[model samples]
Target: MTQPDDIAPYDLAIIGGGVNGAGIARDAAGRGAKVLLLEARDLASGTSSASTKLVHGGLRYLEYYEFGLVREALGEREVLWRIAPHIVRPMRFVLPHDERQRPRWMLRAGLWLYDHIGGRRTLPGADGIRLDRHVAGEALEADYTHGFEYSDGWVDDARLVVLNAVDAHERGAVIRTHCRMTAARRENGLWHIEAGGEAFSARALVNAGGPGANDIDRLAGLVPARGLRRVRGSHIVVPRLFEHEYAYLLQQPDTRIVFAIPYEGDFTLIGTTDADHSGSLEDVHIDARETEYLLAAVNRSFRRDVTRNDIAWTYSGVRALVDDGSGRPEAATRGYELPLSDEADGAPVLSVYGGKITSYRHLAEEAVDALSKRLPALRGGPWTSKTALPGGDFAATEQPAFIAELNARYPFLSPADATRIARAYGTRAEWWLEGAKNWDDLGIDFGAGLTEAEIAYLQEAEWARSAEDVLWRRSKLGLHMSGAERDGVAAFMREGG
Candidate 1:
């Protein structure tokens, strides 16, 4: 193909719209690189949205001696909370003591290391708690009189991914959803890429595909030196088992732990079974065995006898972890490996192997630093850590005040609705909410809190096309809306779009 002067090559082209890819795009673009990010489907439609929804230091990783991974992830918790206070907030977890599991002394030691090892500064330290005397105690079985209380964070996993892409786009990065990469090859010291029936060129490429990283490597005609172990993490949502705010970290019989978290104000989120996956990546769903396993774990720990009938919803996602030949899927390392292909052989391509959402910012920083060596257009150092994602511009402590302000500005909004909008959009909630003096001003109420104005904003700016994108990924309002109400939203999106 002849070179076209009209078409300028992007400094960086990235595959995948998950946390890692979007984070890298944000970092690279802020550092002055012209970046392009391509996603096969909607952003965060893969493993990114399917996470356990935590910005936490994997406290259990201590058992596997993954000190470095835990420490780095711990350090990111505060950073994420600081930048995206709207969506990220502190949560305390109650881990009941099970005599059959690890001994008390070992648990204490692990908690101590977890507190100090990661340079803990903002979050409260872990301490022993009398569950019988606590609000969280009401939901637990009588056998659990004592446990440990520790701090972690909760995140809107899908929103986190979307906000990163939104920030990247605002900073000059091009984000294209439904643009799957069909082929890629290094030619004439540049990467000529084909995706979604379109052609493009970039000085450098990034294979940040989470579960499909290996597939991307094959597409680029490169042999991967390391193997990836794809592990499935499944979660289930049930009716609220506990009324209190505190979450539970239950120890399973198989030496694995399950979390029962307060979700969407009306349900408790649980599970996250670790299973080695070798199935097709499309439409990943919770298996009957995994569902029973999670139910058994929760039923054993909580007072509620949550059977299969109580399951409100279930979701499953596959994680791409570095395969270290571990006997168990959970033992596989969450630490990512970024291998940069030698520029001497061809155009450099950085492939992201494995990482959790907590350390995505750090992972992106490291990825950009390595790629900067190959592409000189990337001129700045790390800025994503201090910078806020899109709507998250206010201080973390000011969120409550922001919500109050929203209520004052839009007195028509219910307190719960105000809080949701504040948390989801932070300061930017005013964008679509502008000039709406009453509920009807926001357009057709599709029930639950979704309105026509919000849907328009989602479509115009957030790349949301279908009703499912609005209902599931962008927000969990699907769980709140009735089937008929959801159909109204769907019909509106179809005809209105």
Candidate 2:
């Protein structure tokens, strides 16, 4: 095919609506570039919704000598918190001292490195404590007497992706969910593409498909990256194991770590077991072996032994990790690579592989910088880090005060409801809450305070379509709803409400 002189309208067309893709879309759009984002399903419906929910440095990665990766992730903890305080909050993790695990001095040294290497400022640094006297000790086995405390941050991982897409849209990017890219070919110095049965053209294309990157690369007429591996991580949610808000990082004999964190107010989120995934990537689920392994790990650490019946919900996600050749799935590297391929006469194509949730912002910035060499429309320096995400304009530390204000402003809302709204939507909760007083004003109560007005708003603004999108991705409200209520919500969405 002969090359043409005409240019495409969109400077960048991003495939995948997960964190990485959304982050890139937001960054490029803010830099005054014309952008288009496409997702095969609802936003965050894939690995993004089921993947890691924390915005912290992976402490266990330290043992693997991934110092650079850990430090990079650690530095983003407070930055992400400052930028999205409503959804990202500081969390203190309690690592109880086990005689069978690493020695006390080694633990102390690791904590010291973790604290100072990241340039700690607002959050508290690590310190040793007596579990026997600490509130976090109540649910631990009696043998545990001492523990180490460290600071990290937890995020509504799905919302983080959604907010990025929302910001990207607000900044003049076209975000189209349920649109799958079917084909791509380089022609006339541009990307001539077929997606969702529609033809389009773009100056550059980014394959940020995460775990499904292999399939996406083939569609884009390129070979998949070699030595890539998919690691499946599974987690379970059960009734609260402890009354306190503290989270635990338990060390198993196999050198694996499991987290038991307070979740959704009344549940405890325990997980996860990492193993090589040989199953289908389209549908990831926790197998019996993974579930049993998680249960055993939790049972060994906590005083209360929870069985299968205690499990309220379980989720599994597969993340594409760079194979470290250690043969252990847990040993795979969490670091990422953004390879931009620019031939002598075709539009540039950038593919992302193996990135952690905590460092997505940095990864996106780097990706944009790589593409900027070819696309002159991508102007300006990095700006996504400094600006607050959608609905996150307020100061990070003022969340509690904001919750209090929500209660006062909406006197009809209970304190719990106010807190949930503030955490999910932050300053934007008032978008749907401002009205004639009382819960009825919000419309149909689908249980757990999920209102019809809110569902409509999500569909209109956040690209939510099905009940699963609302219940699972948009909010974890399904965890609190009865079966009948959940079915009712499904019916409503199916009826196109």
Candidate 3:
């Protein structure tokens, strides 16, 4: 294990490589800061990747009077979509109106406010739909005859985190994926940091350790923030249950919302039952009650009842929320809170409390802007809001042409391989393919559209440190590949390691 002292001191050190941490690192590095990003595990292995994968204003928050949050989120929606059209696409979510829930007028008012909030330009506005007359109604129960469809966007959450890190690294940030930040304490007007048993120093410190922010604060010798709530949210995947691309928003009897969105290509991603978590972040798992709660929510709205037997996969994540002492976790604020060191005279460890996948970029920019206050010599201001993320730089209009061009360049590559490469690497796919002339040129196949060439690119270019990085986070081929294929990839990565 190597530490920070093993290398030169950085202007700033970011604790976590999840979305917020990675985004902050990218912003800080882009501004010419000597930045180092340390992640205990693969990036987005926490709440960032386990999100519902939507990059839109939280509609339900309107009821809770989260106007500012919704507005900010809505503004970022189009910006993020334009930056990464291939990974983030507009999704129309149908919110079924049930008398058991709220009245029709109240729901309509919320939808109206939601549609008008951010001055949306790219996505369509909300519309009232008669579920009985539309195909979206096929899954809904007969009692739910009406719904409202509003537009939000879906994202490849893991890809978003990795792309940010890649962009940050490209801008001269040192990112260690499997590296763990063991300790940090301020000394001599600078904070001493250690990772993977190595040590380093930085003028400023950022604790963006998603769920592990608690330990980070203690290690940095700072008192814990007022309220850091760890809430566990889980999702379940099942075979595709509908034909349309639109997602469904069902109101649970408990006033909570459940989303059933079209996921990957063959399955629907449903989830997210929030449960209070007081457990270790490393050991979070989906409780059986959560599974039952989600299943019942779906069955309550859809006529096509699905049971536990239909579940193809399940994932659980812990959201590190800035608990405002809200007894009800569902009503918990989704906005981020920045808690700065109190008694520290010079060197400060700024801790990020709460944030979401949708608002990570803005949150990152905000974090760096705050950091700029401490280090006035920093060169740049907030530049990430408009700038495209790594693979997101290419114009959206050019993606189709670029994919076509990739297919032309790799005549021997299968359509799926070319598409995967195009989506994953964008224009950089050409550089990854290099001069490979044919299928054999791809080296060994690791199954599920994975090639040795791509793996090598990840290892060399991307900060991929393990098989899980390649399979689960870097690319989601794990879901489609056979167990044997995953084992082969693991073996290959272990041999390389």
Q: Who wins the TM-score comparison? A: 1
Q: Pick the candidate with the highest lDDT.
A: 1
User: CA lDDT, every prediction?
Assistant: 0.92, 0.90, 0.84
Query: Rank by TM-score, descending?
Result: 1, 2, 3
TM-score of each: 0.99, 0.97, 0.95
Give the alpha carbon lDDT tens digit for every residue of 63-147 in model 3.
7898998998998898888888667778899998898898989989998998888879868899999999988988788987888
Q: Compared with the true structure, what per-residue lDDT tens digits does model 1 show for residues 346-432?
A: 888999999999999999999999999889999978888899998999998788999999999999999999999999999889899
Better of 1 and 3 by TM-score: 1
Predict model 2's lDDT versus the native: 0.90
Q: Per-residue CA lDDT of candidate 2, range 1-497, in tens?
A: 22233744589999999999999999999999999998988788777888658888899899989999999999899999999999999999999999899999999999999998886789998889999999999899999999999998899999999999999999999999888888889877778778787777889999989888888989988987645788889999999999988899999999888999999999999887888888887789999999999999989988999999999999998888876687788988899988888467478999999999999999999999998889999898998788999889999999999999999999988899899999999988978888739889999988989989999999988999999999999899999999999999999999998
The alpha-carbon deviation from the true structure for residue 201 of candidate 1, after best TM-score superposition, in angstroms, is: 0.3
Q: Name the lDDT of candidate 3.
A: 0.84
Look at candidate 1 and give me any clashing residue pairs.
none
Ranking by lDDT: 1, 2, 3
The segments of candidate 2 whose C-alpha lies over 4 angstroms from its true place after superposition are 1-8, 343-345
